[model samples]
Target: MLRFFFVLAVVVPWTVGQPVDLEREIREAFNLGGFPSLAVAVVVGDDSPVMEVHGWADRAAGQRATRATQYRIGGLSKVFTATLLVQLRDEGRLGLDDPVSKFLPEGVKLPADPRGARYITLRHLATHSSGLPRNPVSRTERESDPWNGYSVQRLYEGLARTKLAFPTGASGRYSNLGVGLLGHALGRSLDMPFEDALRRKLLAPLGMSSTRIAMSPAQLKSVATPYARQDPSKIVRAWDYGCLAGCGGITSNLPDLRRFVSLNLRAGLSGVEPVRGASLTELHTPQRIWDGWSKATGLVWIVDHTRDAGDIVWHSGGSQGFASWLGFSPRWKIGVIVLTNCGRPVDDVGNRLLRQALKKYRKLSPKFRAMAERLVPHLVATPGDKVKGLFHEDFLKDVPFSVLKNVLSGLAKKHGACSRVLRVDPADRPELANVVFQFADLSLVTGKMGVSEGDPAKIVYLRFGR
Candidate 1:
């Protein structure tokens, strides 16, 4: 069981007509997933991003999670590395079509492949089509942190023994080693460490103070305690990416990540100085098509075409004890970021919430509004038999008239009188019109009312608080 604490950092202004209860939605997700700690941030249009924090950062200490609590972002680090490479290209210091071998340090030879090394280009590496394996061969003793002992020398040695699983540039396959190599090459091109290059180029310009490959003492104190999936009592060690830090070593919190999502939503309009407009545009453009998944690949981002939301570029990542996801819809100008401390996957939670944000609400139909207006007053004024006549037969089978009266009376006492219909969802179910009600106390609640489509329609069902 997971305990939750609700914290809203910035409230999204009511722009799309109805009030979107993103906090309630996030709370439901946190409870359903049993996540020990989770942070969520949502940015809509040019408005400031809104953030919500739930669960415990340190369950034993009873420290509640907050927007500042850091969690490993897993493979989202690859996007940062990819962005750095694109910035270099914009500087005219490198070319995407150039052979990766051109940037390797002196005497560090690439492993031989049947398709030949020259066939693998910087573009192939960034796009995950470089024919490199997911991980380089290494003999690190720690199973939990396999990449911990992998050094630059071992990386080169592993490449010397690696074989291409597919032809170079033949198809898209996710390879951690490929992107790690790209990061290393980018560092070599700039004659600086990968972390320093990343900071100098992307992080500083975007004002992302909390996103980094390594944490300082203050950041370490604020990081959420990571837990195992099978046994929540057992805390897991954070995986050290070592030489492959480019693949998935970054740690970040909601506030910093919200800025990253906002930049992507604005598409270089956020004044990311190091990355030129052309390079940023090129980085997001689909470079390869993935037929099996029915998606495409940008630099390191996965391009998804959703039926309801249109095109959404996204990525999900998991480290040894944390899982994260971030995505944005350029078409919709909405972006979402979710980070959790438990190892269980939270990508679905993030995806569901993003879809929920994209849902449109409209004014309630006159029939539905009139029905609510009549029944609400009756239920609040007289208890049982007065409201019984308003309920559908199907609704009565589950909820007795007395029980329904008690529920409504309790709501009225706690939240005051129902004032107006805030919004309606007619598309969800043909028989039920899901309506939200704003109370005189300024709080909001939702209910579903079912009506028969007859000559004189009558109530068929009613449900609330879902």
Candidate 2:
């Protein structure tokens, strides 16, 4: 007996075979996920974003978030590091198949890596299974800024004390130490600093005005304060990893990322080439298995998969005070970039926003829908389903069909008067179709039960389904 309300139209482009307003969907999802400050961009092409959405980029100052704001591109630094290695390969200074010993100073030996020290190639470092310890230098440095001064001498020093557990090329383990070596290899091969090589090879030619291998003093002044969590009320400063910079020292804002995505969509790692196609496919191609997630290494890029998200070529990085998620679909030519200064979990927020954008902003294939449907079995339901359970036995079962219908109708009117009903429709159960309620920040709910479970019918739930 829930009052009937308008159903949501598919918001994507008309050519995609459905109607949806992806921007509104993205805004709604961000709010639901309780992100205090969020910036979302949908790149239709390399040079421009077809859709952009922002909310409370700075809640304390009452600043509205915009697509122009920047965020720290965490582990994404691996992309630049790996890109530099590929560029070096193209220059014929070395081969992708070259061993670490070839580029190292005489007498310096990398430890027996998970890949045999002699058997493990530079490609393994680019792929992240060199199997160096999780982090080897943080203990001697300031805890708040652990990687600032680690060096080849220090790395060699650590290797002297370090040991490997897994066989090379047989499995993969994520190691910042491994990717850092890729950067080290580049610096040695090119006879310049790691950061400088990136400027000449990747960022400079791409015309990414806002992207950088490191943050300049001038950029810090204008940087948006990142939230400790999605709630904007908590603002905090970020960390600087000096030696780890090769793996995650780069910082970028939305505009620069949008520019970077544009280049990626066009070049697919060819950069600007006399090279006909890619020898760089391994970055996005799967390399190992991790439980439900498969790991792939293309240069330094980490690739994983999901049911509905096709070959999600993406990555997210987190430093002490900030977190970031950047990803795109090569098939759809659509990418989403989310920036948050908070250091904790933000992937759920990022994923929800990305799904919403895909729903309306582009022409998705049937496979996308099939993938999403498959995802349903994987979701653990929130407590909200209780309302239907309670209503089925108590509120819905006894009332005379008409009177029960009227009561639900009246309740719907009451809730409607108090809050806006963005859309309404029949849900899974046919018994009580007139459920009406308002949305709130999911982060705020913690473990609260829906009133429909037993408290009452005031709690809100939305219809998302097959």
CA lDDT scores, all candidates in order: 0.75, 0.57
- Best candidate per TM-score, number? 1
TM-score per prediction, in order, is 0.71, 0.66
Steric overlap count per candidate: 2, 22
| Model 1: lowest-lDDT 10 consecutive positions | 1-10
Task: Please report, as a residue range, the 10-residue window in candidate 2 with the lowest summed lDDT.
Answer: 441-450
Q: Which candidate has the highest lDDT of all?
A: 1
What is the Å distance of residue 1 in model 1 from its true position?
Answer: 55
RMSD versus native structure for model 1: 14.0
* Residue-level lDDT for 73 in candidate 1: 84
